[model samples]
Target: MKIEVRDVVKSYKHKTVLKNITFTMEGPKIIGFLGHNGAGKTTFLNLLAGLIATTDGTILVNGDNVFNTPSTLRDICFIAESGNFQEEMTIAQALKANSFFYPKWDEQLAQRLLQVFALNPKEKVRSLSKGMVSALGIITGFASNAAITIFDEPYIGLDVAARSMFYDLLIDQQIDNPRLYILSTHLIDEASELFEEIFILQEGQLLLQKTTDEWHKHIVAVKGNATDVAAAIVDLEIIDQHMFMQEMTAIVHTGGHPIEGYNVTLESVSLQDMLVYLSKQKARSGK
Candidate 1:
């Protein structure tokens, strides 16, 4: 399922949430949507899922407009931060409801995941714990087996072990069945490896889009004499710089210039650090 957003805009109560956003997503790969709070990530996801209408421009799934079009949405599954459950229904009823909507719904997988998460089908959603609710959302997302599956901060109230299990299950499912997966989360470091591509939003605008491998390519942390490191990075865009007792470290963008001697050491930048630096830069630029 290919998703294409062309010059889209969204607003609520005259407050603009997305501004002239445009991007295209190819199928059978995972994408990480990175942004700070109120960066329009939710708005964008909702637009793609057809949960809300775009104020301007257009969104298409496989060339089909999403809003009011069931065909386009049939293969798309969106699990938001809050999965609005039928308060009067039990977990079993909710599962049954989902099974009818998703053509590829897997009852066995859902039941297994529920068991793993220690959730009872007979329990009412209104009475479940926050973590349990999140677990149910995760299970729904994975078991739906939609062609395009999206999880918008689905692990919000989950613990470390539960979140780890969610990640593991997501990756395992993707390997077994390659599909389009878009994940919107603040836990970038925890889920970065699952992403084949990365998209960043800043203050209602699309900031960056690149393949995860290409995005991380040549990004290194070099430490050595402060002066030498500074000289070496004279023309490179430095993402971050820090100093220790006798050595200084600079996090440079891809293709950083090499410095002679001074014990330069290259390292991979964590996704969390990448997100923090990107957000800081956006804030500094007044975006």
Candidate 2:
């Protein structure tokens, strides 16, 4: 499967949610869609899933416009945190309805997941707990076997144990049936290892897109005396800096080279820290 977003823009009542976002993702891989609150992550996903129309530009799935296209829509499955189902509909009925839209829907896998999540198939949608709802969404996403499957904060009310189980099941499903999976979540540290690549959005813009390994290689943190830290990072792209007393910590793009002879200690930056520092840098620079 191939997805292409070109100069895409989304707006509501004159307020832009996403601006000139462009990227291309092809084949089967797990991608992390990350951002702070109101950074347009969910809005971008909605555009891809054709839940909402783009205000400008275009989005194509396998060279076809995704908006209101039945053929392409059938190959795409989007499971959000809060699923919308008929209040009186039973879990079994909802799953059956979903199967009609997706050609590769697996009833057996859905049944097994319902059992694993301890959800009663006969229970009405409104009667299930918050976690149970999330579980139901997970079952739908995994069983759909769509060419493009997207999960937008799909573990909202799940406990630690249940979330762990979901992750495990997701890995197993990916291994057995490879497909394009785009996951958007606030639980970065927990789900970071699952992503082969990451796309970061900030303030309605596509801030960065890089493979997990490339991200690790490019971002570095250095700590030392203020002068030494600045000297060591000279000519490099510095994302953020902070000083406590005489010591200073700097986040920089190292270009994959060790900085030596400046009495500075270089360390790999965590994904969370990198996001924080980059956001701060953007803010400080009025970007």
Candidate 3:
């Protein structure tokens, strides 16, 4: 599957939430849509899922406009933090309904996942806990087998153990049945390994998009004596810094410069820390 977003913009009233975002992705791979709160991650995802219309530009999945097009939408599945099921419907009934809509829906997979998550098929949607709701969404996303499956913070209210189980199941399912998966979340460290590419949104703009390996190559953390650390990164752009007594640590964008020979130790930056630094820098710069 291929998704193309070209100069897309979304606004509510007069305030724009997504600004001129443009990108194209192809093939079956896991993509991370990451950003701080209110960075328009959900808004963008909704646009792609056709839940909301774009204010400007276009979004195409497999060369067809997905908005209000049932033919194209049938191949797409979007599961939110909360499952969207009829309040009075039983889990079994909801799964049956989903099978009617999705051409590739797998009832066997749904049953297996329901058992794996310990959710009773006869339970009403309103009676499930928040974690169970998330589990239901997960099950729906996996079993739909849509060519394009998107998960927007689908692990909300899940405990650590349950979340781990979700990650394992996602990996296993992807291995067995490859499809395009877009996961939007703030748990960068835990889910970072699953993403082939990461897209970052900041203040309604697509701030950055890079492959995981490429992203790591552009930013690094350095720690050493305050003076040496400062000198080592003097020529580079510093995204963040910390000073404790005589020791200093700084996150710097290498920008193709060889960073060495300043008596400072350099290490790869964590995805979480890199994002924090980038967000802070953007805020400080008033961008």
The lDDT per prediction is: 0.85, 0.88, 0.88
- The sequence of per-residue lDDT tens digits that candidate 1 reaches over residues 1-287 is 78889999997896999999889999898899988887899888888888889999999888888996897787989999895577778999988898999999988999999889999999999998888888888888889999999999998789999999998998899989889999999988788888889888878988778787667665667778897788767777787787889889888875524445555666777778877876777778885
How many steric overlaps does candidate 2 have? 0
Error (Å) of candidate 3 at residue 228 is 4.8
Candidate 1 regions exceeding 4 Å error are 218-252, 255-266, 282-287
- Which residue ranges in model 3 land beyond 4 Å of their true spot? 224-237, 255-257, 260-263, 278-287
Question: Roughly what TM-score does model 3 have, to 2 decimal places?
Answer: 0.91
Clashes of each: 0, 0, 0
- Pick out the ten consecutive residues of candidate 2 with the lowest summed lDDT: 278-287
Using TM-score, give the best candidate's number. Answer: 2
lDDT comparing candidate 3 with the true structure: 0.88
TM-score of each: 0.86, 0.93, 0.91
| TM-score, candidate number 2 | 0.93
What tens digits encode model 3's per-residue C-alpha lDDT throughout 170-272? 8998999999899998888999999998888888888777888877887788899988888898878777899888889998878867886779888998778
